[model samples]
Target: MDVEALNALMRSEFSQVANDFIVQSVAPMEAVVRMPVAEEHLRPGGTISGPTMFALADVSMYLVVLAMIGPVTLAVTTNCSIDFMRKPTAGVDLIASARIHKLGRSLAVGDVLIHSEGMDAPVARASLTYAIPPRST
Candidate 1:
């Protein structure tokens, strides 16, 4: 697949509507996504919320799927499991490194490791599955 075309598609379809997430960089099989930590993204522990991390994982995997399959607007997440390993710093940016593990006609799977900027270990790990739409051509 054309990586540039896929990136463009992601920007067009998701970037405009994803207020908290940003596509920092994109490659053929990998992508780096960032989410700014905000007060609204915090839970009772005064750290980033689980839902916020889940959103990051979701978007990161979505970008990875798009990178491999081009821009399929109908590509949807069928399953997602995330493990939160640590608390995220409130003011730091959360970065997710997403890589596609399998890409097929009907489905795509990827894993994302999310970390706070400057952190050595990941704060969360997520495995995601997305249903890819059929290609027209």
Candidate 2:
């Protein structure tokens, strides 16, 4: 799926979380997702929360795989390892760049680097695996 198709699916099928993200771009084995830092996503320290970052990382990879395999809503994350590095820039949108290293019939694996908007170094990095449901065939 491309950006528009994925965004439309998000709005139609997953409206609950659709407004929080933007399917910015997709290319071969790669995708970029954007999440604007909102008041609700912040902690008491004015920093983006861990769960919020994890969500971005997870969803970013999910979109990347979807870009390759079409809209597979049943695909689920089976494993994720994330490390929070630097503090994210407050009030800045976060950008997650995901790259698919391996894609298989039943699984897809990738790594994601999340950076605060305009920053060079990533604030967090994640490696994830998704369990793609069997095709009807």
Candidate 3:
């Protein structure tokens, strides 16, 4: 799927928080998702919350899988390991760049680097494994 198709899928399938993210781009084995940081996503320290970034990483990888495999909503995260590296820049959108390390018949593995807009280094990094359900023949 391309950017528009992915964004539309997010809206139709994941409407609860669809407004929070935008699909920026998609290429072979990769995708970029942007989450516009909002007041609700902030913690007491004026920094983006860990859960918020985690969601971004998860969704980013989900989109990458869909971009390559088509709209497989059953493709779900089976494992995730994320490291919070640094404080995210306050009041800026977060960008998640996800690359698929491997894509198999039933699984996809990828990593996401989330950077605060205009920042040099990533604020968080995540490695994820997704289980893609067997397609109906």
Candidate 4:
């Protein structure tokens, strides 16, 4: 799948929050995604919320999978586990780098690292498993 095509799919299919996440680059089994942190993404401590970071990781891996397997809307997150690391820097963007380790006929597994822009250490890491849709007759 193509990067531009993947982005367009995001725009058309997920217009609700599509603009929030950008598909920076996508390759065979990897993708870089970015989210321009807004006030809505911040929490009581004025830092990025855990849910926001998790969303970044989720979408990052989802886009990577889509880049590899096409826009399979039926593909769903069957399982996900995320670890919140250091607190993210305030007032900048968040980036997620995801790499897919396995892509089988029924499942896909990948990991994502989230970084607060300008920070050296990762803010969060996530492991995601998705269930690919079976082909219909």
- Best candidate per lDDT, number? 3
Residue pairs with backbone atoms closer than 3 Å in model 1 (clashes): none
Model 1 has an lDDT value of: 0.83
Q: What lDDT does model 4 reach?
A: 0.90
> In terms of lDDT, which candidate is stronger, 1 or 3?
3
Candidate 3 per-residue C-alpha lDDT over 21-103 given as tens digits, one digit per residue, 9 for 90 to 100: 89999999999999999999999888999999999999999999999999999999999999999999879999999999999
Q: Write the per-residue lDDT of candidate 1 for residues 1-137, one digit (tens) a residue.
A: 34455446655666764557777777777988888887788878679888889988998898778767666778999999999998888879999999988888898888999999999999999999999888888
Candidate with better TM-score, 3 vs 4: 3
Q: How does each model score on TM-score? A: 0.87, 0.98, 0.98, 0.96
Distance from true position, residue 57, model 3, in Å? 0.2
Alpha-carbon runs more than 4 Å astray in model 1:
1-17
Clashes of each: 0, 0, 0, 0
Per-residue lDDT for 1-137 in model 4, tens only?
A: 67788779888999999989998888779999999999999999889999899888888888898889888987889999999988898789998999999999999999999998888899899999999999777
Model 1 lDDT-worst window of ten: 1-10
Index of the highest-TM-score prediction: 3
Off by over 4 Å in 3: none
List CA RMSD, all candidates. Answer: 2.4, 0.6, 0.5, 0.9
Query: Where does the lowest 10-residue lDDT sum fall in candidate 3?
Result: 37-46
> Which has the better lDDT: candidate 2, or candidate 4?
2
**What C-alpha lDDT values do all the predictions have?**
0.83, 0.95, 0.96, 0.90
| Model 4, position 38: C-alpha lDDT score | 93
